[model samples]
Target: MANAYVLVINSGSSSLKFAVIDSQSGDAVLSGLGECFGMSNPTMNWKYAGTKYDVSITGGGDHHKLAIKRLVEIINEYGLAEQVTAVGHRIVHGGEKFTKTIRINEEILAEIIKLSDLAPLHNPAGAKGIEAAIEAFPTLPQFAVFDTAFHQTMPSKAFTCTISNELYKEHGIRRYGFHGTSHYFVSREAAKVIDKPIEESSFISVHLGNGASVCAIKDGQSVDTSMGFTPLAGLMMGTRCGDIDPGIIEFLMKKGWTQEQIFSELNKNSGFLGVSGLTSDARGILEAMEEGHKGATLAFQVFTYRVAKYIASYMVTLDSLDAIIFTGGIGENALPIRREILKYLKIFGYKENEAANADARFGARGIITEDGTPVAMVIPTNEEFVIAQQSAALL
Candidate 1:
């Protein structure tokens, strides 16, 4: 048989990201992003063999379907479509029904759609992408790699909400942490760095990106995580408000704010953007802070402090802390954020290696801490690889 190639699709509310990976070698043969989807000017930007390509699509009604069609056309143009044996989709919320990766079918697609309410901003968009892929490649096998699957190992004490048990039983309201693939990948890599078996290793994997979260892994299993029930409950992210008081919602409602208004504020207008009254990107926030912007300074401090607090609190769950691995965009690239976080975590004997931390940026992976207990390290996450691996295994 020809070498199996898996195409991993991560569809968000406004964009679709894809990578075609060689399953055996775990390398991305091609990757791209379709941005401004569902808008007047839809654009597909891709990289192939270190070369860049950008094309604008005109009059594509549904960008999800159009993006997949264009992607398929590109694959066929390069004569690489024949090598693609399977497709893997990144589903944000799997609820309790799916605890592992599974083959996608009509029934499964329907279930994913049914779970849309749980992840209104993600599931609907993901379902649209899946449908489009299925239509475009009817013969190809596809699988769903869920973000919530990795945290299924969490105990009831860790996942259960403080609300009434009846409400949880009826509504399935509990902590279903996001960013499981990144946390799982980094934790395994961290074990290898320390020359310890993952089955016996304990780690706090911090995934700080536009959408951030922290995970505590004990013996390769998720014990507890920062995000609860939805991606909105985690560490402060680009636009989402993380860990806000419940009373605030009620207070806003009493002030004549509709549920839609409140939801929009929390999910799209809050977090670093809300606090700083500036752009949501961490880089922009940091730049503004350097310019003596008080709001930017406050936002940056809160973001780092919340992350540090979670890392410290997760220590209680680990009997033996092998290392704390930082992955994702902010975690791997932002040196000052890493330093500030470590400064607060001095109790764990973590001392940052200034030069090493400075060098670890833009996908560079290495230990950034001086040789000591609970070493600090940066490991750029490859979630697409994990999706491909899981999809190929299912096939």
Candidate 2:
């Protein structure tokens, strides 16, 4: 098994990211992305050793199966297919059935499919990736590493919604946090950086990517999180509206808006894009703000304000905070965003080291607080490594 590899697949709505990691060292032997799936001209971009390649796939552009088959072909071309010992998939939503990493089998496949309704845009595509992996390497063991599993330790008080008992008890409607893999990885890293055992440390992990969420970790367990029931309930995200007035939905319904229209608007048109009427990428918004764009400036203010408020709210749940970690795209980069957030958090005795904050970006890990009470850090997340490690352990 030392010579074998664990292939990790992360299937997104319009992209497929696959990596072949050395099972023993957990280093990526090869990694690539198949992007723009379901589009007319889909492209494949990958890197090996020190070289990079990008090309358009001819016809296999609209399906996960085709994208995966192309990935297997690339692996075979490099003579690395024979070294694959197992396949690990990143499943976004597991409902309540999958509380931890599990081996993929017929029954498990059925359950993953049944859970698709809970995550229409994610689970279905993940299931398809699993099926394709099975077809591509029938002899290899396949595992499902769920994003929701890490936050399953959250107590009921943190997850329970104030809706009808029937809605929650009958249907599984409660806060099921997303980005658990990133949060879990960063929290452990934070504990290590401070030279403390994770099981005895407390952390507030902020994963601020296109999709954002904050988790309150007490003694290394998730006590509460920002995202609820669905990923749309947390902090304002790239395109999704977070924590909005419930009455707005009912009002839109009364105005003759269809459910499909409302759903599309909330999930696809809201958030930074809706607020700015421009783009969802934070880099673009920040650049626009520099150019005196009012909408971009307002969007930036609202986004940081909401994130600061959530971080402050979670502080109440932790008896003693060990550190506050920032990961994901915006969290790792976007120094302006970090500065604005810490400004609102000054009441908590947090003071940012301007030079350190500006220096940390795109995988540079460091502390950004100036000898603060609760340490503030910028640690880039490695979710693929977590998946690979879990898969190898199961094997």
Candidate 3:
């Protein structure tokens, strides 16, 4: 078992979430997250093999660099650095360039940088993590597991935007869907739970998190999805104004607002947070709903309405759906939100099983759909496992 570990790094704009797992077994030996990058005394927290390892690191102008340094240090300090085989990085957007797990080389690294503008918040961080890992583990192999890889099965019609051909060729202006890794893993899990072979099942996956999107899986492949050219194009996200009129952006520009301001409003100042004038947190909104808060109610309605509409729209893509699966934060945990979504799904012939719906044990996986109706289930997503599995296969 020489060099049997594989390190998985998922980097965000200001945070790096990492895990070290046994490549042979896919069991995470340690996991950690570093937050508040570029700020002083950022939170560097971790859990190593069942023990909590939380600590703050003071002074960091470049937390990405610091995060990698700390991560290497922790690996060495815990006596778990031995037999480290390779690094598997979660790259957010691989564009149309990569459709599978790829070994990283200078050429691949350059290509990743080329696509950074489209995923400004994520790609750069991914590149930074890759660079730092290469510096530290120069002799080790590294693989990139792309978020957009699974959605590559989407036909041109589903991913192609109604934009100009010149823009498409010049700027890659097409619907490069995100969160594909999550949808991919959860859909397979759903297929298993429904006792159907993946290739024989058709499912609509609703991934509801801070960033939300729905995907339609037909014959175990992604046929269509809600997200467009970016993650901001689908259902109402925590802050992002998903599916807003493009005219609003043009209207703002006419008012003499800078491009930066308009982007900020659509990406940051909208969604449940914007509509409710309350916290973007679903938990907080649900709490307000209990207190008879109208704004919160409206926010919840908007969220569910978009989800239901897309779920129905996606049904057309699937021809006929065998099951509907829920994954991501809100999709897995929010009971009331789940109930509301099912209420609108009656048109799809989804008759919610009240007993199972209210059963807290059904939190992770449940048959929300009534007997003989299309299966509806909850499958906890495991994107890291998918990466690990893919990395192991490469070995």
Cα lDDT, model 1, residue 304: 94
Question: What lDDT score goes with residue 393 in model 3?
Answer: 73
What count of clashes does model 2 give?
A: 1
49-136 in candidate 2: lDDT tens per residue?
8899998877643467787878888899989978888999999999888888999999999999999989999998898889889998
Please, what are the lDDT tens digits per residue for candidate 3 over residues 42-86?
Answer: 888899867898888655367777778888899899887776678
Report how far residue 141 has shifted in candidate 2, in Å.
Answer: 0.4
> What is the lDDT of every predicted structure here?
0.92, 0.91, 0.86
Off by over 4 Å in 1: none
Clashing pairs for predicted structure model 2, backbone only: 175-229
Question: Compared with the true structure, what per-residue lDDT tens digits does model 1 show for residues 231-309?
Answer: 8997999999999999999999999999999989998999999999998999999899999999999999999999999
Minimum summed lDDT over a 10-residue window in model 1 is located at 367-376
Q: In model 2, state the lDDT of residue 120.
A: 90
In candidate 3, stretches whose alpha carbon ends up further than 4 angstroms from where it belongs are 1-3, 23-26, 59-61, 360-363
TM-score of 1: 0.97
Ranking of all candidate structures by their lDDT, best first: 1, 2, 3
Residue pairs in clash, model 3? 3-83
Error at 395, model 2, angstroms: 0.4
Off by over 4 Å in 2: 1-3, 60-62
